[model samples]
Target: MGIQRRRSWRFILLFFPLLVFLPLLFSVSELHRNSKELDQDLGSKRSNKFDHIVLGPAAGEGLSNRLQCSGLEALNKTHLSHISHAFNCSEIISFVTVFAVYNSSQSDEKLSDLVTVGNNSYSKAARSMAILNTYINFIQVSMPKSNVIVLSDPASELLIRRNNVSLLHIQGDYSRGMLMLQRIKSYIAFLETRYEEHLQGKHHLNHYIFTDSDMAVVDGLCDMFHKYPDFHLALTFRNNKDQPLNSGFIAVRGTPDGLQKAKIFLQEVLEAYSSKYMKASRMLGDQLALYWVIKSHPSFDVKRFSRPEAFMNEIHGAQVLFLPCAIYNWTPPEGAGQFHGMPLDVKVVHFKGSRKRLMLESWNFFSSSGSDISDMLCLILKSGRTKYDF
Candidate 1:
């Protein structure tokens, strides 16, 4: 009996060590697999480059792909304002044209062919171009994403694919004279339909931003998000005729409820737009709709600024830290064209129509009175991070 007991004991001792090491062995194997997966991802990112990357000579030309684009100083700063405000954003959409007429110049049936974006839709194209351009620049320096949404089917899909950004198409029968709804209603419908998919996209990130294709991002809004995650993602409201809040740029909590609310508001607001008071709003149809809709929902806190510095404007100040106007209407006389010969301090150049032309001209003209980044560097070395850079 003693001999049998000893034999059993000896067997237990031998096998116990193997049992103890089993979890450790599996853990090491799992960790190795995870590490390998991570390595493959990093390798893929390294090889993939932006296709339409346009790094101007003045804007960190030849800098690493991660470098901040545009002439905006790459310094991060305090963005938290009073909690009274929330993140401002708008519909992730596009329009055929502001004009009433419809054209058959293009067809999605020919996906293989190069679709020419006609200049007749110049205003819409320019505005959308600015939005897309800003989106690319924002991704380079800030939170880059693989998915992007463009209203309707665009030929830009191939270009976006080459750049490694996934294109999401917003569908609509924008063919012709339909009286059931107008431009704003169509946009609302698209968001409502796609909201669920958008919410599910959080498998990759926590936040999602939707802006009117007209608005250009000048600086990284990441600062705002970092400061306030719980804050409602709202937008700057416009109270005046010239200075109005654009719902074009919007930030949401990336939830089904938020998407539902946005759609609900858009639908309810269309009726408001169709109302006599809204029609009287004349030039500001969407603004009128938003102003009234916002009033209805106290939960959504939308902010409006009266000055050039609030969101983005042409009003240049020699002493304040400017975000280089994410979205500025630069149609001549009203601060049109680029601020020529101005210091490289301007982070972005928003071209608004004739104003856009002016800004591009001014960009050539917006020269330094001789003090370039070299002089600025000398000054930075002499001083440190201070209001002096303003």
Candidate 2:
């Protein structure tokens, strides 16, 4: 028995040294693999000049983000500085977003039935085309990259000039653009499916830019993103104080974990939106769900800040006649009939619930030159008079 015990102790002592170094060896191997993979990817991108794609919805007044992507792929002459001080890269890798819900054509003669959202009739496609044109024109003239990837349904079409652009349509017996709050459940579910495919060890995108069709990209997003060589996330501000979760404009890292988190959020958001039987279940639908997502899980890292200025209109300043400006929705203050002379500092304006301020005259681009910008401002001032009962 003493001999057997000594034999066992000897074997254990002999294996302890091997075990101590085994973990260290494994760690070193994994680190080497990761380093090699990153280096190889960098080499590939450098060798091929640059390879990136853009995703956009075919619906909405302007597939603004997509067009901006296209333009960046085509133009952008300046080899600008880093995206931030941390990550180092030439420019943004891709623009991935949902399909737009607007029409491609905006010709006055060929246009007909406008999709009625609330009060006024909106010429669905043309508005989008106008928005798209602005972005494409800017990027194509400025940054021009490699390609674009757009996601949409069958009823949607992907229009891209030159091999520089590409469109990808996705449908699952669900009408995304037309769906309201109740039907929006499926729209959220579809995001999960797409995320799975995006992470299949295939095209490892650098960033995932998520934008709804209703939103527009007026500025050079890629040029702005280039500074963030290896950016973590880029999300725009949400003005909805009523709802805590704002899902309007979001940008995230193109990593497995980030993508999965988005799926989880969308799933929860859809579930919450679908629970209309419980009153609060329909808590602001998408926006409300987004609010909950931030509250529940802190991973979203949501960025909140006003575009140009933080305080343009206060809560007390919101009314029928004394309206703040086009930046906020709802009627204005009775004393104030127009918004032209109003002190306003805003880069992008959003019209929620209320449909009173949309211009009757079709002008989607809103003029780049400040010369026409005043006239554009005046036109908005005139439209501020109309109010929607619904």
Candidate 3:
């Protein structure tokens, strides 16, 4: 009886505190659950109220940390010097962002629908400019020393002038297939002009990145050149089977030999764009042109054994490197989860089609002055407003 009594006493002692605190713990847990529910309700309300703009998945996670401008030197292990090294300040690659603000007719015809976000209705031109402004702002903050060029028509020039982004005036119907061909011609001419200056010792080796205006750069690009130093041209590919290559983002090395190689590869692409497939109007866009050129190459064979697997083939004596679209030219769906890698590792985000609104929203959300988004858009969309310095 004594032993049993002692055992019972020990059991009571062991469970006494739990008995006393069990109700308190449950009450605290319920309180927390209620608080979490309230926060979610508030968040949903805010989202509906600001449905005017598209927000990134990381809107609340703070995108300022993803800028990566401050970590350039540390990441590249170079002082960003203007010397003869890769990605030098002087021999830097120029980033080319293209947009079509007006049609070929020179009338006030709208190319895209006027997007009504919140209380403001933005014209196609205004939306294009706003996205371009976001891109320029990103480049200025992330790559101040690198050159940025805008390739568009005269109508676009006027809208672009407000931001002081370098303009490459192109004249023509700013439509799809036509614009793609014009981009090739204009880019070739620009390269030739720079090459001529290089012969006169007026320029160093030139390089360029052709990208869409609706894209944003989260990481510095020095690593790309350094990692793929051997290739003259690099193309990014999507997961689509029919139109796998994405021509929106291309990296070109402008050394004399590199230029020759790129010219050969691009010439093939240009010819393919005009081929019978394109004439049949079988959706033969630039992406299709790239696909045909790549697939038709004599040395093209799928070698799937390599790590970070990519397609590499010889094109008319030039080495062409094909990169995955996930890392280079990400076109993720709206409201998708976070990227696969670290945010700083994500080089570019192509906010194509309707997702262009996300660029504006992301800029506003990440900018130091978050509330100035409408004010900034007004400066672009309306007149008689002070220019917002990019």
Give the top-scoring candidate (TM-score).
Answer: 3
Model 3: pairs clashing at backbone N, Cα or C within 3 Å:
52-118
TM-score of each candidate structure, all chains considered together: 0.44, 0.45, 0.64
Question: Tens-digit lDDT track for model 3 on 1-390?
Answer: 999999999999999999999999999999999999999999876454222442222221234433122211122112223122223444477888666665434332463445554344666446656777778876664566677887777655354453436777766556665776766666666666666676678877768888877777654667667777889888876556567677788888878777667766777877887773455332346677777888776777533212334566676777887876656776544212223322333456766654566566556644644422222222111111111111
Candidate 2 lDDT over residue span 235-262, tens digit each = 3333334542234444544565545555
Task: Give per-residue lDDT, candidate 2, residue 45.
Answer: 58
lDDT of 1 by residue, 1-390 (tens): 999999999999999999999999999999999999999999976555321212223322333421232343422211122111213222121211111223334542343332222221233323334335444543332223223444443322323332534444444334333312344665565556557566667332344455443332333345444544443334543234443445444554445655555556556667777773444443456666655655445443334333444432111110111122223222111231122222222222233322232222222221333332223222221211111100
Q: In model 3, how large is the Cα lDDT of residue 122?
A: 65
The lDDT values for all models are 0.38, 0.39, 0.60
Q: lDDT score, residue 321, model 2?
A: 11
Candidate 3 ranges beyond 4 A from true positions: 1-91, 103-121, 154-159, 162-164, 170-173, 279-284, 302-311, 334-344, 369-390
State the TM-score for model 2. 0.45
